[model samples]
Target chain A: MEVAHADDVELAHRIAAGDEAAAEEVVRSLGREMFGFARRMLSDSGAAEDAMQETLLAILKGASKFDGRVPLRAWGFGILRHKITDTLRKRGREAVIGDVDPERDAFNAKGAWKHMNFAPWREDEETLQVVRDCMETLPLRQREALELFAVEGKDGVEAAALLGVTPVNLRQILHRGRSAVRKCADAKLGSDED
Target chain B: MDDRIRARCDCFYQVLSDYIDGELSEEEAGLVREHLLLCPPCLVYLEQFRIVHQACGKVESDDLPADFDVVMQGVMTAWRKDRCGDPEPGS
Candidate 1:
């Protein structure tokens, strides 16, 4: 994400002033993205919506708390992340840390390919969509890591923190997740005769 | 490939994810680039890595409620209520 500028700062000020229009604007602008984030974390539409409502409520109530130390959007995600954590905790669920070993999956002790059987993926939109589909086919543990780090562009440290792993462990999870999804997508596309 | 080179390739390929994300040190990335020039498999892997990066960097989001505005209005009402006893905001 690019750095936000003065406009967002102004928006924060307006919202803090208790302007209803400003509150609505913030909800409309970030609500969808936050919804997407909530959905990814919870994977339940009703729970996601509940979390989103709570996030929006937090934004409105906490607008005065935004000190402008970070980009407004970044601060917004921080709140959303907290809301997601609260929702997960209330449900008695924890974010599972994936232990996929890319090195073991892709290479033998000799550093060569092992158990790989697929053609290269075509660089088209359709193939990319298939890549996303293959991403969904992965176990939720790996999928969540890829979704947070790669797809959502979250900070590795934050992602690792959410999953309760160190940064190095998170990178290994991302590598193994990417390798599995890439291979699965390649095979699915190569066999499609399209 | 010699044992030393092969060992280096293995090490380099293992963390290519970090390399692709620009997480590696300059010297580590430089070493990987040098290995890429000598290894066809690693080169292909790099290309696929590009594809994965491109594909993952953008994704479509689903699962938004149809009545988002309505729900948000309800949330705003409660927010307005909490800050003050005023039933209507901007009063």
Candidate 2:
């Protein structure tokens, strides 16, 4: 069953008060989503696993300090984001924003016609598989915004909240992410005009 | 709106993901909506955006492995036990 909206915050409060069951529930509720975010951010399964552990640890340790200004999930995601940044910094690598204009033009030129052609092939399972494969080609922030906004049902504001960016910035990332994925999907779907 | 604004209506098509998702403010949404009503290219872009949104919506969050939950449960359990010094598992 899906977790109720208030239960997440309630569980965080209880876990802060040393309730083991609540802590377990919090982990179970947010684990997969958090894992996916970490994996996408780190791009290394082992590092992602470590990041997940660190995120949970931070939640456990920092739960008492939560200001309750945002949803528990968002707050948890905030903690996870910090953990990711810290991990990356420790590894001597920082998040780099790719050149948006050139990348955009390249994908737009290649993808304009390709996506138009691939649109009709959507019913094919292979085409959807190709889309999924193409998703991995996007940069971390773009992929996160796309995954959260499109796949996980978070609105732009919520996604931006999770990523620590403004909603406008999140929208820009989503635009670029979709364009890149569409381009790659087009390439994978082949050039046959249909 | 001037010819420049009219010509750039297609540019807003790229941002329809934001608009349809309610990311735009009331004023901004009004501007885009007006453009879409007047521009065929923007309308086509909106349709494509909807299609992509629908296609993306079909991807299940169940893609995560079942074992992930089990592993997380174990990890949380261990963390709790460590915190509370519990001897019995899940007790």
Candidate 3:
């Protein structure tokens, strides 16, 4: 297998050799990020913990067979993504309460901006809170897209694959999510520009 | 915005993420690039998009649950038992 990171490949080998230290290293390196990702992906604390545990177990079990086509971190994320999806499935679909289509509201039927004007963002703690609140309110798919692309730092192709959407679809989701958050923040925080 | 500028901005909006992601073809990206130079509204939107992107990245991470280590230990113990028929390596 074509390993992306040499140290990761070494770690894989150590893990395959039943090195507990290597396993602990993996946990230390990836645990917080995994928990954080799960927390954001699942609203319930117990569900997030369950997903994180499942992902870590899956990683330890699969380490012997690690092919290293991607970095160890990305591999762990893929497993975590699967766990999150499974958890979401078991939870069934969340309620569609007050689901407004921002795209329709923002763009005209002909695709021109209906509201072209925007106040420059006033970056502050309040702005961050507004963005977080807006993100939480977004539809699951759009939130996941933003999480993977913006927060998790996955590229378009990788995020698209994780979300099981085409690149075009991923972009659409990201754009709409961004627009909604921007609109929300602008409304709440007003213009930094005087 | 003028009708012509609005028309161009419409095209740009559809591909905003793609443009930011560098996924657009060079020709398409160049067109958007040229449009941003003359279009204040679209330029503001682009900058705003970037700000939001940065803000998203700044969302604080919550600490792991208190029982995280215990749960992980439980998993590793179970896995060890499954692999070696014992909870501990030798026992």
Per-model TM against the reference: 0.65, 0.67, 0.68
Q: Across residues A1-194, which tens digit of lDDT does each residue of candidate 3 receive?
A: 55667788889888777788888888777777777777877867888777777777788878877777777877888888777777776778552322344655566776656787765665567667777776776667777788777654546777776666787777777888887887776776664434
The candidate, 1 or 3, that scores higher on DockQ is: 3
lDDT of each: 0.71, 0.64, 0.73
Q: Residue A146 error for model 1, in Å? A: 2.8
- Docking class for model 3 is acceptable
Deviation from native of the Cα of residue A141 in model 2, angstroms: 0.8
lDDT of 1 by residue, B1-91 (tens): 2234334556766767877898766777777777777776777777777777666665474745898777877777878888786757668
Off by over 4 Å in 3: A1-30, A43-47, A59-79, A85-101, A105-111, A151-154, A184-194, B1-7, B24-30, B59-74, B82-86
Candidate 1 local accuracy as lDDT? 0.71
How do the residues A48-150 of candidate 1 rate in per-residue lDDT, one tens digit apiece? 7888888888888888777666666667767777777677767775555446554465667766666444356567888877877776566555765776675
Regions more than 4 Å wrong, model 1: A1-32, A39-50, A58-95, A102-105, A115-118, A139-141, A150-155, A161-164, B1-9, B59-71, B81-87
Q: Please give, as one word, the docking class of candidate 1.
A: acceptable
> Top model by lDDT, which number?
3
DockQ of each: 0.42, 0.23, 0.47
Worst 10 residues of 2 chain A by lDDT: A109-118
Q: What's the TM-score of candidate 3 when only chain A is evaluated?
A: 0.68
Sort all candidates by DockQ, best to worst.
3, 1, 2
Residue A97's lDDT in candidate 3: 24
Error of 1 at A168 (Å): 2.9
